[model samples]
Target: MDLRIIWFWMVGILIIGYAILDGFDFGVGILSLFARDEKERRLHMNAIGPVWDGNEVWLLTGGGALFAAFPVVYAAVFSGFYIALMLLLAALIFRAVSFEFRGKVDSSVWRRVWDLAFGIGSLLPAVLFGVAIGNILHGVPIDASGTDVGSFLEMLNPFSIGVGVLSLVLFVMHGAIYLADKSEGDLQTRCRTRASQAWMLFVVLYIVMTIWSWIGSPFLFENSLQNPLFYILFVVLIGAIVFLPIVLKSGKMGRAFLISSLLIAAMLGEMALSLFPRLVPSSIDLSNSLTIYNASSTPLTLKTMLIIALIGIPCVIGYSVFIHYVFRGKIELTEESY
Candidate 1:
């Protein structure tokens, strides 16, 4: 009913959309480094090629929504996390170049460089994204004017670093599961093994980070738990985590991968729920925090954007689904292929 709540849903949907879509693409890149050979790596790349760029549209929309609908939150977040965001942007650029140029250059040396770039690029975003979220959860230092006046070092604390690694590992695992489902032969087996290994590490890291995050900054969990919906989302996430390994071990790769995607969605949903109202949690006081009320655009702007988004998002999603369905199944690297 309220424009503020509408804006909240709009931003939340886009944020989750980006995490679910680009997330696997990053995972594919992580797996590329461990692929058995060039051909295997090519298969990994091919599996994501048809939709990777399209998947990125979700990210663009998410950023656009923030800038349009919630300018204050956008300003504070982008400025506070400017350095980290810049690094992420750079990594994304390198990743795009690595993807395009890696195949064009026939030389092994050139391809190797791209390969390394791809790995680093994937890793940096995965880790940094988690850290960014972690920092927000921990509450960044804000001044009397409600501006994000925190130092760079303050953002890179131990808690954020732990969350960063957790993000990287989680996405890598997510990618591996997708590859196993879409690929066959030696590469598929390798992906499964890698996914299994990543799952083990992810479980350990996720638990530790969750506990530490709550202990170190109880407000994140406490605020979230105050809402019944938050607990519901948490249960769904936990269930997905429990369900994934069983599906994988049962040799249902497709189902397992689908469940993995759901798990990612659930986890992101939990974080969003945890951080609701406060876009950038203030370490100082609740009154100083940037909530949906303080951060959103005017009601007229919000209403206009809502109408446009309702029309636009579905079209983008429809096309993405169409392409994904058309390109469903394992990628075959033939001489005729791009």
Candidate 2:
């Protein structure tokens, strides 16, 4: 097997893992904004408190993998999406600060500002990430030399905006399901109702976005259509779609959330498969796109990095599981507890 191919899948897995774990952290933050009361908001916050910061490690790993395995693509993407990337970083910083310091202050007004900041901070990155991926799918308008020639404003269009909205809705729904699992009493019930209401919207948006991506995304559809393995991926995607409603209707929070996770993983996997070899698809032509083969570092570097990943990923997973198990109960805040 080609090492390039291996690195390609590894990067995809890293990103998907981040999305699955941290996506809920963002969702919980968004939920905090509209929660019934301060205690309810705090419950939402506490549900994710222990793991949210740690969840971001996957992103760092993914980025490092990209820089090590596909340096050219990383450089190009970072440059092309500089403004959006900066915005995401800012949001992350503010969210982290709000999470840490909101309770440190005594004034209600001061804490309220932090609360709102946390909500917006979390919300911005979640939506913008989807938009960034959407832009990738649609193919950024690069020049003849395969470089970014358009301004940031030029990147924002109907397709990318739609994807941003779709991602926000999906994650909010994901968080609601998680909240239902981790909370009790009024908050749990409310979260379930919210999840039920949001699930339909997510379904509609995902379907529409998928269709739009298929028909309108030159980079995604064109390449995938040419691949013989595309049919197999298509079948798996269809299966996930069919399985979703069944799982949701089953009303088992664990099973339903698991299904959601699977659906998201499958979708992201398909997207990666569709653009296989190409890390950043060029708007001009497929030939101009950044492929793993063209962008990869030396074999020595890749081997060393993979070795580190082999040792590191398991440890990370172990710690994550341990933390979840340790805190495995509904978040309740009594006067004394708070």
Best by lDDT: 1
What does the lDDT read for residue 32 in candidate 2? 90
lDDT of 1 by residue, 161-277 (tens): 888888888888888888888888777777888888888898899899889877877767767788998878888888888988888888789888788878888887888788777
Worst 10 residues of 1 by lDDT: 329-338
TM-score top scorer: 1
Question: Tens digit of lDDT per residue, candidate 2, span 235-264?
Answer: 766775666557656667777677667767
Per-candidate TM-score against the hidden true structure? 0.96, 0.93
Backbone collisions counted per model: 0, 0
Instruction: After superposing candidate 2 on the true structure, give the runs of residues whose Cα lies further than 4 Å from its correct spot.
Output: 144-146, 223-246, 334-338
RMSD, one per candidate, in order = 1.5, 2.1
